[model samples]
Target chain A: MMTAQIKEFPGVGLRESDFEQRKVLYTEWVPNARYAWDAGVAIGRYLAELKEGRLIGVRCRHCRRTVIPPRVFCEWCFRPMDEWVPLPDTGTVNTFSLCYVTWDMRRLTEPEIPAVIDIDGTHPPVGILHLLGEVEPQAVQIGMRVQAVWKPPEERTGSILDIRYFRPVREG
Target chain B: MTRKVAIVGIGYTGCRPLTAEVSYKELVYEAAVKAYEDAGLDPRRDVDSFVTVAEDFIEGTSIFDEYTPDQLGGMLKPNVTIPGEGIHGLATAYLQIASGLVDVVVVEAHSKASNVLTLPHITAYAMDPVYNRPLQANPIFIAGMEMNRYMWATGATQEQCAQVVVKNKRCALYNPTAAYGANLEIDDVLAAEMVAYPLGRQEISPHADGAVVLVLAAGEVAESLTDLPIWIRGIGWCNDAPSLETRGWGRAIYAEGAGKMAYQMAGIRNPMEEIDFAELDDTYAYKELQHLEALGFCQFGEAGILTAEGVTEPGGALPVNVSGGNLGCGHLLDAAGLRAVVEVVLQLRGEAGSHQLPDVETGLAFGWRGLPSTSGAVVILSN
Candidate 1:
């Protein structure tokens, strides 16, 4: 038999105040982790098109799957994807979350609706994550039709946010 | 055929919410000492190689593995670091021993999750710097979004997800190492402060601080160290596409692929029958159900129903996460998976007093490298 078998969890627990009371030296690190990730061949053109107020995707010759935020190579097919295709800014919500917190656990006064929008002309489940705007939080539902609300060309910086949040499309 | 590998010894330090008294180095030393003692071997003499799992950003240190040798008694030995999950480290150890170049291997994984001042900020860096990081939403929002898709596709409910918390935490009450064990009810989980819609604060696992070390040896080497060795029947790990946009949202395809490989290796034609129990990745409560479905323990949507019907309780038919899952035990970043292995080891050895189940021969430990990574691994063990 293994000796000194752990019958109880052997770790010392401390309260938040214990550090202050014990005068523990806590060091804070502010890391400047900056990187200019090359959007590469696929995303470079994709971002360029986004700045031009358009959406784009790539078609894989093997799987025939349309990849958005396009990649130079098809992940499933593991082959080069040279076909660039234009896509509509309109799409449907594949999934969404009404987040009440920010990246640093800070509370928000109003919940942010982060969603994965299935853009038109792409595979059903393949979508980019973006926020939803101009729709009631309660009114948001999965599969609701929406269109991207783009920023003015002057304010665009070839970033994903060039097309701001998506809004629910009203039926005529 | 590949040679066999067995986990002859195991030792763990914690699944505690905080471990401020000791530095992460001391925690690693304590765990390594216990593991060596349990295996009845000297690390410098008997162990051939060492593997530790860590990430530069998560540890608050660059080249973090450089500082590992002194504490593990691994000075001047072959030591490697994997920046993936605990099971990945273990798999590497298994591979080294199976190659016959090494007789025994040590695998270590730990988390001082409480050390990082801005954990969410560090986690944000893991997101796709191009598409996802710019969103700046809480990373737990990903869990909420998946939970929504899972529920929408499978008919799982908020209440059913809450029951997972209820069961896992209640199971934790009997587990000594589990930090967040509670007598939680479905309402308590449901009523807990909502952080992400369709997901409450209680549903998300709070981080814990701890280290786990396991000594694995090949056939004869294993028997020489311990009479009762938990044999590694099979191991499998897989990942989805690098980008979240390209993968299926509702299904744990990684788990499915990993399970298929592991089950095939173990000759498990029917997972629901051949496997005795599982300690799955319940990083979020819904993940337990999702992983269970992916592992073929039940149909896609039936796991939530099983949880609701008491089919997954400790004494129930499929008894999942008897060590309280992550919900009850508190998660340990990359080390969470190896902690689950310890629970299964104790149970197989009939050393899990109070929470031990009877007549159990085979068990499984599945782990996920949570958030912004869809990597998962599965290991099946038998007594």
Candidate 2:
């Protein structure tokens, strides 16, 4: 047995009835604030390119790697990226998950497929996280070929969602 | 000679699934009072400063620090808040003492996860708004992807991952402070529903409500105050890539870098032979294996074999997380690391009772800030 025992500190869990009774005693307020974040220079350009129905990346000359979800500055080299490069819509699934719950904590009957897709023409494994569509969950595998399914040109927004989702690439 | 900071006193309260009777401030006060009593010092006089750890989104309050000091008895004394884990706050306190800025300092952190109605939303909010958040997927999906990549890269089977849940959850059965202790077999774990592929519902830790307070003093002050001082032998923390795409998928480079710096400070050349045991972050079962490789406990992709051999079980060669880890003890968020610290202190002082290990002279602890974030911390304690 331990020589010195710290007494257990207990907490009273308020029951539903207790909450109802204490409603008059407590104060409640909902937060009301809206935000409009700027996508900034690199992401701003990336979104604009998506609006144009093209995939793009920035090349860090020093590291000689074309990075997607493009950044103006190279995180590794600490230098400005040299040039903009066009990337192919097709890529490989680096990894993926079958999600049964929604972001707001809702249970879903149809699972959401989220995956990291390594886009072509970018450096190896330079991927973007997005959803997988037009494929069964059991069919998804690491290294599976996939291609972006863009929103219609008229419906395109300058946001990442402009790429509807990725689908399994059909072979010739 | 460089000054050494030691943890002279510790206190904790409410390691349960929910704690509605007392508000978070009251919870902090309970721990602070007990810590002060144990150290035989008055926070009003003896303590020179205070540090509290918390995240704003989780608290649903901006500037959560505004509500911290009064309950900590830190009313007027220099008190600051770290926007990181509990052990990070301790690291700040350690720096304060080592810098000769103050002699005695107190660190506090607490969790009221039950109050969080939209945890997945808050987790998604932590992601990159431009690249990751718009997908609107559950944040656990990232852990699933990482787990899949880790298994594919290292050949670590799901069976090995399930075994971690079995070992840690059963370890909690002997821990009086653990809230989620259970008698779990690997088969039981394997049969659990998969939340994300490779990670079962049982493999993830449930959120817990708790608070931990620690009193740290300079070496001389510590020796004068308490005979059972757990010396901070080494401490380190690091961050990998802020973006998940660029970071290493199979291993935790952050924990590796942090553990390296800590080991260098402690003059430990070999962790496996020199360190007695560890209490690593096991928020997700696969994380325990990933962190083991990162912490240099074993070679790359070798934690599974060691675990299978019962080397990390209590009464085994390396007794990792005899207090049940986060898997059995519940995830305390920012307070998670300090909970590990509290357990290490108990084991070192031989006060762990039923879960006590024999002659535990030194211990190591690891804490991760959770998914969509690669931040982590490491601390070593010696009696």
Candidate 3:
């Protein structure tokens, strides 16, 4: 038997009424539905580009910086990104993680390896985060060169999945 | 040596899983008003500086700093907003007072998560767009991965992780303001809906709506205002590698580093024996265990077994999260850290009511910024 010293302090004990009040108050404040219109359009555009087998990023005219995951404005320069540049799919892996569990905690028979790729052909090391396919998790190394694998044109959506995963490229 | 700072007054709005009766601004004002009254000072005249903690992504607004002053009664005060946890904001306030730059500082943090339409989508924005977001993997999945890694590294079991939720929620049953309090069995937690593999909904903290405010003053100022002033004995905060993949997911290196820094400053070597109680961040059940190891409460991976053995429960060895923690109380983002401080102050002052621990001469409060972001703060408070 563990005898831990217990001290008494003054205040009301947890009241059933308090819990009931809090539960009701919390449920009532929850927003039932929320939608982002711009995000939807952005996804549609990205999916369309993916189907075309071209990797595009939004470039800021003022800062001349390209964002791989294209955005309307350059976060750094606070300027609208109007130029769409097709970026070379080859890049080096900056970091990666292997996920052995599913979103809902069901153990996966096969794990997925995701990597942050610093794609070539862009200033300031334009990077994109995506799946690392055709490579063993143990073999994948930081700074290893990889190339993007595009899905067939018919199945391409301008979304990120358009390029299935980045595969290791053999250097000449 | 720096001038000591003390918490002269602390006030919190009743916490609920959600609050629809008031807007975010109104919620902040209610707590700020209570804190001002408790300090026996008028916010408009006495407060020399004001600090608020909020995140643009969480609040679903850009330039969130612009909207804080109107509600906090800082119409023309030196107010700055921090884009992190409330403890970071409090630490900033402590520095300002120690520098003799401010005499009295008010720190406020609140969350209105219930106002957001889609929390998952909002959280998805935090993911790396090129790879991680493409998978539509929920943020909680990262926690799952980390929990799995922690267990593998430390040889802890799922049962131990589930026990954390069981312990915290049960402790919360003694806290009147805890939102998720209930009589729960460990099996109940294990059987709850799994949001991510190895992680269940019960393992995660419910989103909550509430605000917490604290009035900080220099030692002399505090002595003049209040009979009992909880001294800020030590404060430490640090950030680890931002790339989640590059860092070890199982252990909290940042928290361990921060805790050590704080303990050193507070002259504490044996934390388990020196500290009376603690309020650790339990955003996820595994987080509490991970932090316990990091905070040196027990050996690595021993938290699971210790928790299963009822070591963290009230009346157990070094009671933890007596205010129910984020799991039972609710996750209020920036306010979560301040809530820990508030609980510690309450316990130390013997004002915690039903949830107070044994003679709390020294209390520690810890906060974690959560996944994909590695920031933590450790504050040691004493009466």
Candidate 4:
């Protein structure tokens, strides 16, 4: 039995007051870095189409998978994608969550419903991560049909946020 | 049978919610010194190369590699930083030794997670900027969604997930290095405040500050260094599509792919029988079941049933995470994988003391870089 000497764990748990005092003696810096992120060739076209109230995906003939959030190359085949395929604005909810917290770990009074909406026309099971609106948290279910609620044409931007959210598409 | 790599020595700081007494550099130095001393070799002379694992965004320092080498005694020697997780560093060291390029290598990984005030936001930034990051929702929801899908697909109830919290935390009680170990009932886990639907506060591993340093040597070098070196049998890592749009909601393709590669390399045909035990990523409670299935421990839905039947307990058949995993030991981020490796090595050496298991010969350690991405690494070890 090789029992090593167990030393008292050398970590300290401090309160906000202790942290504040320590910060007073040292210089603190806040990062405000910004990025211009070029949308690149594939996503550049995808976002441009989103601004025009359309959803499109790139097609790879080799793998025969139509992928959303389009990329220039087929991740599976490692070949340049050739054709663009327009997809339906409506889709099914693959999965969802009722979140009571924000990205910064702050509590929210109302829960945010984030979900993966599987687009209707894509060959593969391609689902985009986005928010769900106009539906009760308890009402959300996997395979539930939904449609994109786009921002008015005049206010649309070349971004994912161009479509505000996905809402339950009423059954006819 | 060209060459064999073995873990000659291992050292790590205790897991804690905060390490305010020392800077991150000092933490690395502490572990490095202990590991070198344990191996009976001076890193300044014996270590041919070095690898450190860290993610820049979490550290608030861009290109954090610049600050690593000096602390590990790799000053001007061949040292490189891996921007992924710890198991990846171990794999890199394993490759270096097997390639006949280095006789001995040092692998270091650490996390000063307490220093990051906006961890969730920082992690959310890892999402696709054009499609996912704009949602501004808490990243835990990703786990929530996955858990929901997993439950629906595998019949794994939330109660079963809570049971995992109970089991791992209870196991942690015997581990002196486990900081978040606790005694609680499954009901307690269920009653904890919900962070995201189906995922409660207790179900998520709290972040901790810690570091792990390991020394690896090839063949005779290992034989000369330590009488009880743990041999590396195999290693593998893989990633699913980096986009949320294409990833499977109910399965862990990454773990399956990585585990298959490693199993093939190790010549392992029946993992559940041949491998003595395992330490897998339990950063999220439900992930234990998910990874178990992905690693081929059982069929797609059988892991939840096995957990309910006590098949994964320390004394049970095919023991898993006997070291309490990330759930009880606290999540060490990039260092998390090494924590599992450290536990596996100690158990294999019969040096885990109170937590030691009898007659264990081989073990597996697996790690995932954690969400918004689906990358994983696996390493097999034997005594």
Per-prediction TM-score, please? 0.70, 0.69, 0.69, 0.70
Q: What are the per-residue Cα lDDT tens digits for candidate 3 across A1-172?
A: 2334546546757778877878432322222246332232333455567778877777777776776766544445433467777787899999988889877998976788888999887777868889999988889999999999988888775568878899999889
Error of 2 at B233 (Å): 0.7
Interface RMSD after interface superposition, model 1:
19.1
Give native contacts recovered, as a fraction, per prediction: 0.00, 0.00, 0.11, 0.00
* Deviation from truth (RMSD, Å), model 1: 25.7
The better-scoring model by TM-score among 1 and 3 is: 1
TM-score of 4: 0.70
C-alpha-based local distance difference test score of model 3: 0.82
What docking tier does model 3 reach?
incorrect
**Candidate 3 backbone clash number:** 21
Interface RMSD of each: 19.1, 19.6, 14.5, 18.7
lDDT for each residue of candidate 1 in B1-383, tens digit (9 for 90 to 100): 67799999898996988776666766777788889889998886788889999988887668988977766778788999989989999999999988877989999999888877777887777777667766777788888888999999999988889999999999999999899999977888889898888889999998998999999999998888788999999899999996868978899999999999898988998998998989999999999999999999999989888889999998899999999999899999999999999998988999989999999999999999998778999999999
DockQ (model 4, Cα): 0.01
Residue B307, model 2: lDDT of 88
> Which stretches of candidate 3 lie above 4 Å from their native place?
A1-172
RMSD of each: 25.7, 26.2, 21.5, 25.5
Worst 10 residues of 3 chain B by lDDT: B125-134
Error of 4 at B204 (Å): 0.2
Identify the runs in model 1 with alpha carbons over 4 angstroms from their true place: A1-172
Q: How accurately is candidate 2 docked according to DockQ?
A: 0.01
